[model samples]
Target: MTKTRLFHSNANGLIEHDHNRDGIDRRGFLKCMAWAGTGALCLIEGGVLKSFALGTRNASQVQSHEVAGRLTFVQISDSHMGFNKPANPDVIGTLKAAVDKINALPQRPEFILHTGDISHLSSPDEFDTVDQILTATHTPIFFVPGEHDVLNDDGKTFRERYAKNSKGAGWYSFDKNGVHFIGLVNVMNLKAGGLGTLGNEQLEWLRDDVKHLPSSTPIVVFAHIPLWTIYPEWGWGTEDSAQALSYVKRFGSVTVLNGHIHQTMQKVEGNVTFHTAFSTAFVQPAPGKADGPGPMKVPGDQLRSLLGITDVNYVQGRHALALVDASLA
Candidate 1:
């Protein structure tokens, strides 16, 4: 297999991804408008929120890095491509807009990490549509599954398309510039907007997967549900994540990422920092803000502004994770 490392560097942060071979060409670009000068899209302007319906702001400040000891990449989750709701009628449109934002960046990410929910209904067409849109970028894309992608069909199609190389029902790991990345599947049979579960077999494999790695190695675990409890009432966390996490507690630096909650919330416990990324599709109500978890209808103007992605970077020789969360609006 060809080995490729993709990284994006900006004046503010950096993201790097090392993955198996895949070639990206320019056709993946989705053109919405033509502009002559580089625009600086405002992520947060004076803390006054803006509408995401218009699309991503063209960023004026962007810088790519040379080969550096440390870098950054992005975490975009829950892109429900086929869903057409008032929250945003065109999720695929927004997803394409996100790709445009990434492609427009001065420094392309080494790769982009998508944490499941690639499709709303697990349809072959839905997956295909998402793939075609993401292919616009030269950056590589890696993925895990959300319950939505695995419902019915036993995740057969999802595994076939995204995680074929993954062992034991689609869970696997890879290394990039000394960082160990683990992608886990925990939403196979998720209840209606409920908790996430990782079966015993996968847990056993997880233990073995990290057994040989030194405790000093930095580890990043990406799944679809929160590995740490966010709100049990919403079924927003993973049931066996504690056991899965136990094996890696010895490691000095561990970052866990998930997307089921559909909002941005973060927590740091000891060496582990748990983050739930916002959805590229739409925002679900915050914990206890609504009756249950589902598509939340926001002002059309505010939707894209609320849609965002998280950027993470590992400092060389240390266990610290520097994070930047940027919104598409």
Candidate 2:
């Protein structure tokens, strides 16, 4: 395995780059894109947030002991399994690489959380390929539908295969390790500029769902598009997320995970931390960095490094959770 450079956000609101054997000079790269492609490992415990790197330790050791005794899960987004373009011709191959990365982890994640875009086209074959490949991890999986996943049939197939237990539009919630996990579907009705929308029905369900939970419960909300405003011109945000977020604001710790942009970006608001994971299929330009959002073909040598996975851990009784991002390279 190649040494991975980890980028994290510190208390001072600055991103700290941990240099490693890769010698990629991340500071210079971050300067070029304003820190756009950097990934993060977020630790939120006791209502406080802290950041750390995956460091130069042995991969297995880092995986096994990074966040012992905490609730740990893996977040992978935008697999786009059927995509076959110059940006990435072997989507299945890369997806397998992601599975391999997870399987090699010393500590198996309790479950794999796939934010969205499991397929480029909502075809049976596409979904099947994704399902077959992901099974190798031997871990239960959770999903939220991305715009691409609902393209033709309004997510009819996606919901049938991956979200039967979910409610209208496949939105659902469950409890795990004392944490509340909510999977939301926002790609059903897109607003102007392609922004995501969580209809009133889903919003109401969300309100009632968390109404009974104690304020101390940690909430992990996953969706296809970002719940916060992130370059609305590009349709990177949700139109009614404010209403949804309003429901969880009283909670002490809320972590919102999303995928769609194909790169990593994070924001911290009062009690909410919004994070976007990278795509395993291909990379997309930074917000407004290109004319529009789509597959971006980078130098072949750099593709794997630009694509990666996010590992998240929450230590019991600790006031923080730890997240580590590792590249396929």
Candidate 3:
């Protein structure tokens, strides 16, 4: 079985819980872990993501400087701009709140990765508004398309607007500070229940993309849908991700990031860490917890608590990357 560590945000602080069941205690806190501990211990507060420093015992909050990472970036997914519904009457407000968190990071991220669903209905105005808000950060941004982004057209406009450097089906790769990052487009030709599909062409390109890199090089792959099967019954997984992952399985460290399920879920298998991010606009029912997956409405006061952002830090020379999910609340 794959080993996974999960921390859920609560009114008090982060709560380590059983992934199989939700038995969270609102007053509990994730036990403090030393900076150099075996696994990461994230403390969420004031929208800042930080790690406990060495020699520190138990603290609910600390400074980002306490974290050790040469490369740090932020991930915000499934914004669903222009979506004005009871589930989330103000998607723009929540999305902006998410950006505010990125801007508030004591250590501003080097860049931002918008996983997908940039627009609610692939409308030009929705795309324009998001672009305007994101530009305020004055940071380089990267993107991949969600199925919703390509509804009107088969990603032609999306490719021209956001993925000019991409290869077949809006897939692309780049390097930053010795780390290789790949932006994949699996939302195209989605199966029922939004199961993502990465055609053979993109898989071939991926195979050749990292063939020459030393296995020690860390790899970060971001897409709109989960590469690992989250809930195949709900179409929450990629149709042929096994073949795609096979290409990079030999690498010492591989981190796969995705956004479609609109919630945080993680799995560590061998050298791979598969993580799904929460949406900024709204939340969805946990896998199989509801009849299906869609916008899950909640009390207006509790919306932000369920929405959040993900911060990823890569500590150079350690082959280690830490990911923390913090709520906008």
Candidate 4:
């Protein structure tokens, strides 16, 4: 097994984490992660969240409990379907591998969450190719766009196709087996390497949407960029997320899921659990790992091993939501 490398990010930069052989430290810092290209399964029980790694190297410990809950779902992001760079030439093949992993799960996910970057250049053909491949999962999927996905026409075509039910800029919310899920769009108005923002309209909508929910409701907020500040210099965090997060502050359990950094990250603040899923397309540099955040190259033999898919579960009686991450390798 490849030795797993765990990294922790603070306001300064990324640093290594001390961990046991299995590479898990549930008692460590609130901000932590096993490097990109790994996955996790998440389930919610009694308004709390818990997560376990599903790295292929540790399959023996996770295969059976992956979907152990009332609701099971998976999150796969940043497919970048038309990209052909050396960072990952066969983005298609690796994405297929992600689906294969989901199919092999003991219990299939009820649905899938795609955090965005579905296409490299926002071309119809690119979206078409991505759609063709994803249809194989045989599961429903919900999406919020990334900067790469909203190019050309300001996402008009993208919305018409995937988010007709969504209001302005494709933001919406839904409920599943008791959990309240909010899909947010913060990639709009993006400047080059600039922070993500949720304008006043969306913010108002968010505030109104959850104002009536009970404090015990489990809330899952998914978006394309990190709602919390991960690395401001690299535009890894959101600009108005503070306002967005305030809406759910009363909730007993809040789980925020996102992509766009193309890596895995997690943090706990008060009652909220914020997590970012790894990309299926290509890997990106860690905070300050390179001159800036973009694609990072890995040898072809090691690429598939690094691509990951996240599984999320919501368990009714346990008082927590559990998440496990698994890699295609």
**Per-residue accuracy of model 4 over 72-148 as CA lDDT, tens digit each:** 88888999999999999888998999888888887789999999999999999989988998899999999999888
Candidate 1, 51-138: lDDT as tens digits: 1212233232212221123556777888998889788799987898778777764445678899999999999999999999988876
Candidate 1: minimum summed lDDT over ten consecutive residues — where?
A: 28-37
What order do candidates take by TM-score, descending? 2, 4, 3, 1
- For model 4, the stretches where C-alpha displacement exceeds 4 angstroms are 1-69, 191-194
Question: Which stretch of 10 consecutive residues in model 4 shows the poorest summed lDDT?
Answer: 9-18
lDDT of 3 by residue, 169-188 (tens): 89999999888999999988
Question: All candidates' TM-scores?
Answer: 0.78, 0.85, 0.84, 0.85
Q: Report clash pairs, candidate 3.
A: none
RMSD versus native structure for model 3: 6.6
lDDT tens digits, residue span 75-144, model 2: 9999998899999999898999999989976578999999999988888899999999999999999999
Worst 10 residues of 3 by lDDT: 29-38
lDDT of residue 308 for candidate 1: 70
lDDT (Cα) of model 3:
0.77
The lDDT values for all models are: 0.70, 0.77, 0.77, 0.77
RMSD values, in order shown = 11.6, 6.9, 6.6, 6.2
